[model samples]
Target: MVKESKLLPRPEFQRRLVWSRDDKNHFLDSVLRGYPFPEIYFADGDVNLETGEGTQLLVDGLQRVSTLIQYFDGDDNLKLTSAPTYRALNEDEKKAFLQYDVAVRDLGGISKEEIIEVFKRLNATKYSLLDIEINNAVYAGALKTFCEQIAEKDFFRAHNIFNASDYKRMGDLRYVLSLVGTMVQGYFNRDDAFENLLDRYNDEFPMHAEISGRLQNIFDFIEECGFDPKTRAWKKADLFTLLIELDQVLHIRNERLQPSKVLEELTSFYDGVDSSGVNQGSVSSIYYKAALQASNDKINRVRRGAIIGGILLELSESEIREKLRVEGLA
Candidate 1:
């Protein structure tokens, strides 16, 4: 025969009430409307028994059970009443709830440890909770909120420039922030000091607001560079080389090292190569050599010719010959 047990809350189980407002409302509406729901399971133990008679402690489905009790007995407001309502339940109401026959199943005298293991497996399988999303949602303080905002607006658009598969593989928005941080650090005197100053400024003044703006401009420039913006197929190594050339050009041309100048130079380089009918496989190779020579103030005629020659080697002989004659490289 099936052993009959009373519905009770477990003392050891603290109710976390993790359900969102929408989730709670929908659950309550379903129950009140007599809509069928999946059977609520409970992991029975000494904790449930210790709470004594009349007051049934919930082992699982605390939010659902609590919602029902509150709606039926207390105020119908349903906004998870802040004041304690459980202790105020009268004798008749308490008896009615206790007598409420919920389908109860026993684990056939399973050990406490075994029961816990079963409970964990059941919850894990049922919810399909993502640990990272849960952690971010649960402790969603200031930084997490800021990160989420950046991701939704800036990161989402920027990442979509690549193919869908590549974007998903890149993981979260933090990686993009880290890359931007790396670039920002390159401009300052002391990297740590700059980071500290930025953090302090963000805390006091609203200077960090510019970060989102800067990121938008950066992505815009990347789009104009003729590389597939969505897949970011330009490659990180290529970007690094391009950044070096951009920095050099900005310094030499007495231009501000801002997003606009960066974009202009990047677009110009690609346009120049395309117009010249240069068949260099990777523009990065040319930019790398140019950056190296520019850094040493060795960008003279001879050095330029040598760099151009190296770039041409990557092209077919006929194409290189034609490009050489056109550019006076012959």
Candidate 2:
């Protein structure tokens, strides 16, 4: 109830709601089963010494409290393991639920930075969201907004470039940002390259919008070229490489691109790779893993971009050829 009060504002710093339905259901199940929850931390505020009224800001556990309030109010359609909803509970169930004690540690007059630190320390999990989601929360400016536009586009849905969870977790948005970031910076580093670009999004907010526009144009070109859906070109490293290279050179091309031809060339390139000493069975996974790893390396990024450029050059695509020459690339 205090959460709804404007006197205590906790929305100043909070993680994105990336919890899955299953995760919420599991938590709700545990609550209904009388299991104890972890201590939720709060920042203490000033109080009226006489009336004993004061405001407290939540430092952590927003999701948990949100889920509880949502379930009790029968607002969200959460699948319950034990009962329908808090409102559906019997008198005894209601009494037990109300009587259930939740642990809380309130720090008086905590600084905002200290509260954010506490919040981060508490949510250290595989779903800890130290990447795009967290960054989006802190920098809820143009970058986050542009990412939303890209993720919500019909092109991504129709092409299956990214899914619902990818959107929720900001994976798809990060992928596009990574490609654009790599191309714009003229290099790809195995470490910190992506991180540095994301941090710059706060200041380079307008650039993200321009990049989004170019990206949409590139996707349109890919579809116009007739890329085969069976090639799964819409996913992973191949798509990343293709998009980066196309954005660099295709804008100035006088002729249209042939997606089927590009797919065929790419497929042939993969099929003809030599794995002389690689073991059979699951060992092929090593090569697959290596290809993915190369997707981030400086040398490999240049190589992959050059491969696409070479193909276009062969077809008298002078724009790609000129780009390679000017960039001092093969």
Candidate 3:
């Protein structure tokens, strides 16, 4: 339909194409991977009464359908970063890609004004969408794709870092984005810097290889430490803090950390926090409180990172306590 001009991808009233090459690459990747995307919507267009032929105005999914046409035509503009391009795929894969199903809705014989209303209504919503959802829409580029790849690594899978709700809402992407973002530019409160990071690295993430290496090292080091599944280090918030701090010590600070020492100290500190109870004067109690309350806030994140970093440095409990006390944190 697109090739024969029976279906129009963009009518004059439709928004201009704003997808980056990176965005197109990732979308193509999804299609090649057989991942389902949201449906497209179309409305009726002019009919050639004598010929019994009619056209359809693409009311929604302009980017997706346009990408598909470009990929099928083997357009050079649609480069493959992580997925095989159409010409590169084997015969069976090419057949599968060509046969991929796309869900679509057609609004039959609607007037232009009704088409406009339908488009607006399709996009309208009373509830606010999450930041991850907005980012997923606007910046389907390199950084986002990198995070998506990292989120699928065996380390995260084995540790069960993400829950079902996280997967359902792209929270896994956000989580890995947060990890990489914090590694590059230290902690900020609750995804505060995610959009900036996503936009800044959308075209090309130059640190992709370097960051991947560093993250793999961190994951391996964490695994070598061999903390039990019951350890708080496996919990989301604590795991986040541990990874951030360990990244600081091992990568940023260029300090060596012993796996056995890390395992022993972290286990003890996590257990201390777990058993600290209401003992407000203890460092473990303070760390425990911060981890439990508004944990994503800059102050609490800093508190958690400092304690964990110090532990990774093989600091004594008393020394860690004194440092926090001097900083008026404990």
RMSD of each: 15.5, 5.8, 11.8
TM-score per candidate, in order? Answer: 0.30, 0.74, 0.65
Which stretches in model 2 have alpha-carbon errors above 4 Å?
Answer: 2-13, 44-57, 163-168, 252-290, 315-330
- Model 1 Cα lDDT, one tens digit per residue, 1-330: 011335554333232345555776687555434466666555444444566533333434556666666556655556643333434667865565455555544554455456444544555753433333223223334333444465566434554523443233222433333334434443222122323433433434342465555555545554554454532225343343343334333333334444444444445444554344223543433433433433223232223333333332234445544654565534
Q: Candidate 2: TM-score?
A: 0.74
Q: In order, what lDDT does every prediction score?
A: 0.43, 0.65, 0.84
What's the TM for model 3?
0.65
| Two-way lDDT contest, 1 vs 2, winner | 2
C-alpha RMSD in Å of predicted model 2 compared with the true structure? 5.8
Model 3, 1-330: lDDT tens digits are 988998999774454455677988888888999999989998889989999899998987888898898888888877767777788889999999988999999888887767666665665563234677656656768998899999999998898888876775677888899899988888898988988998999999999999999999999999999999999998888999998998899988999889998898889888989998755777788789889999888888888888888888878789988888787777
Model 1's alpha-carbon lDDT is 0.43
lDDT of 2 by residue, 1-330 (tens): 464472353464575566677778888888888998888877866677999877788777777887787787787566665556887789999888878888988777887667767777677876675565455545655555666676677876887887666766667767766666665687566545655665677565767656777788888877776666756356566677778777777664534567667667656544533332334322122224434555677765675566555664453435544555576643
Could you tell which candidate, 1 or 3, scores higher by lDDT? 3
List where candidate 3 sits over 4 angstroms from the true fold: 1-128
Between candidates 1 and 3, the one scoring higher on TM-score is: 3
Candidate 1 worst ten-residue window by lDDT: 186-195
